[model samples]
Target: MARPLKDPTGAELARLNLNVQARFKAAAKAKAQTHGMTLTDYLEGLIAADISDLQAATGIQEALIPKSA
Candidate 1:
């Protein structure tokens, strides 16, 4: 069995090969840095926030902390 040891956050990370415009990526990275978060964390937070509502309806337990109602 392969040990999933690379991710220190305890979540098994998956690779996502996203292709975005260079300008968009630069903007996102700048925003992430402005907020004192890594680019990955900022993107993950955005995805989590977007799906939090659906998560309640479907009973999907996401690792990210959902917004308070």
Candidate 2:
């Protein structure tokens, strides 16, 4: 039986504009492909993990979360 799709993270997203060297971009793309992940998924995983680490180190969870408008 198939289940209905749901919002994966249930959080709104904001655009991130990064400027990296061409080599770095290609390296990240290759790493994502090697791990069988789309570049977007791989980058999201990385950012989320980093944020979790930062939250743990700083003990300021609210600071990391986006401010509600």
Candidate 3:
């Protein structure tokens, strides 16, 4: 069986902790009915929209700049 690698660095771990806390807070606020859907759903929707925008922008950029090589 393969063994696990070393733990994350302090800064990386702190960032992860902050992210988790932020999500938890968002979920709690969502539970209070501040937003329409749950935190998970809200994040998913936001991520999907972000990806769509990225794709559209990339396509426009490609059209404006011809591919070389």
Candidate 4:
């Protein structure tokens, strides 16, 4: 027999209201289902990726700026 999966601990819950076209919503749901992840997990992954990209861009921009003595 296999052990059961453990639930995540200390996770915070958030509520969001999005207004989108029906087709768009359906497409997103289908994509999430294909990846075998809940919609929440898929969205969280996207948000994390965006944050990382933004941080990298910011670091590059800061490095390009000249420093004054």
Candidate 5:
């Protein structure tokens, strides 16, 4: 099993690193409030949308590609 992060090291600093854009964060917060959902749930839904889009794109690309002999 994975161990927990130890303090007094760089773990706290690492945890502070955020890659999300400011606009996305604000939009997520607003949508979550509108739907009465926690921010985590809103983000999960957003991620699900992204995954679905990726899958659709992949399927379209596959359809366009010729099969190997």
Candidate 6:
């Protein structure tokens, strides 16, 4: 038997407005549905991925900078 999902506790919420076209919004919802994820999950994953990529790039850039004695 599959286990039931646990409810999240003490999670904070934030709200933002997306000025995207209706078609883009629909497409994103459809993509998320196809992957069995809610729209929120899909967006969160995208944001997390972008943060990771930016961090990696920053690390590389820092490494290339010369340190002054």
lDDT of each: 0.58, 0.53, 0.38, 0.49, 0.47, 0.51
- lDDT at 49, model 2: 65
Among all candidates shown, the one with the greatest TM-score? 1
Candidate 3 — what's its lDDT?
A: 0.38
TM-score for each predicted model, relative to the true structure: 0.60, 0.56, 0.32, 0.55, 0.38, 0.56
Which lDDT tens digits does candidate 3 get at residues 36-65? 444443443344456766335433222222
Clashes (N, CA, C under 3 Å) per candidate = 0, 0, 0, 0, 0, 0
Which parts of model 6 have CA positions greater than 4 angstroms off? Answer: 1-11, 53-69
lDDT of 5 by residue, 1-69 (tens): 112233223335233345799998898788676755556545544554667673354332222222221
lDDT of 1 by residue, 1-69 (tens): 112234434546688789999999999998776766566666766775688673453222333332331
- How well does candidate 3 score on lDDT at residue 20? 61
The predicted structure with the larger lDDT, 1 or 6, is 1
TM-score for candidate 6: 0.56
lDDT of 1: 0.58
Instruction: Assess the local accuracy of residue 33 in candidate 1 as a C-alpha lDDT between 0 and 100.
Output: 69
Q: RMSD to native for every prediction?
A: 7.5, 10.6, 14.6, 13.8, 14.5, 13.5
After superposition, candidate 3 runs with Cα above 4 Å error: 1-19, 22-24, 53-69
Ranking by TM-score: 1, 6, 2, 4, 5, 3
lDDT of 4 by residue, 2-45 (tens): 11132133335456778989998888777766666555555654
Which pairs clash inside model 5? none
User: What is the Cα root-mean-square deviation between model 4 and the actual structure?
Assistant: 13.8
**lDDT tens readout by residue for model 2, 1-69:** 111132234434456788999999999988776656556655755665677664464323422232221
